[model samples]
Target: MLYLWIKAFHIVFIAAWFAGLFYLPRILVNLAEVPPDSVAERARLIGMAQRLLRFATVLAIPALGLGAWLWLGIGIGKGPGNGWLHAKLALVLLVIGYHHGCGVLLRKFVQGLPTHSPRWYRCFNEVSVLLFAAIVVLVVVKPF
Candidate 1:
């Protein structure tokens, strides 16, 4: 019962965290396209990015924690058939790196500095989708 509850919350928080991962990059795309002198608009977008990042990070902590508890304590992937889980853990690290990357890009934008072109950000935005898809396939298919 505890395991089911943990899994449910884990799914909920994972969905929420991925939601942020998906959107934050789109915001970066907007940040890149903001007119050079559009001070008010740039500020507003930066502010939104900041808040969203914070919100995502807060959710990520618990999501990660619950995931750890389920795996380590509840033994979701203990013993045999753990290869898929190992791969999934690698992808989870990638997700964390991507989340950190968003913060790095946001910091540069907030500092009134030049950054990548909107096209680059558009390309970058697709990364999270790929990661999400890979993780889902690993979790669901478990083809290891």
Candidate 2:
């Protein structure tokens, strides 16, 4: 029963996290297009991205904790070679890194400085999307 609940949380959080990951790049692109002089509009977009990010973190952190518990705490870590588990954990860490990178970029944006070019932001977005997709595939297929 507890495992089922944890799985549910994991699914919901993964969905939310991916949605934010996909949308944040577009937000950054839109912000870049806005005139520099339009301080108010730029600030609005930045704030929106930040808030959405806050929600993503809220979902991700606990969902991760619950997943770990569902695995380690309940002894679900008995798979062959533990290959599937290791891959999933590595991807989860990558996702966490991406999450933190987004926070750093958001902080830079809040400073009103264009630290990342439009192309860089786009690449960041694509990488995050691909990593996330890979995670989903690993989880579903469990290809050892």
The candidate that wins on lDDT is 1
What TM-score does model 1 achieve against the real structure? 0.98
lDDT, each prediction:
0.95, 0.81
Number of colliding residue pairs in each model: 0, 0
TM-score of each: 0.98, 0.90
Considering summed lDDT, which 10 consecutive residues are worst modelled in model 2? 74-83
Residue 26 deviation, candidate 1, in Å?
0.4
Q: Cα deviation in Å at residue 95, candidate 1? A: 0.4
Candidate 2: tens digits of C-alpha lDDT, residues 10-120: 788778877887787777767767787998999899989999889888878777887888788886658676588788888888888888888888887888776767777
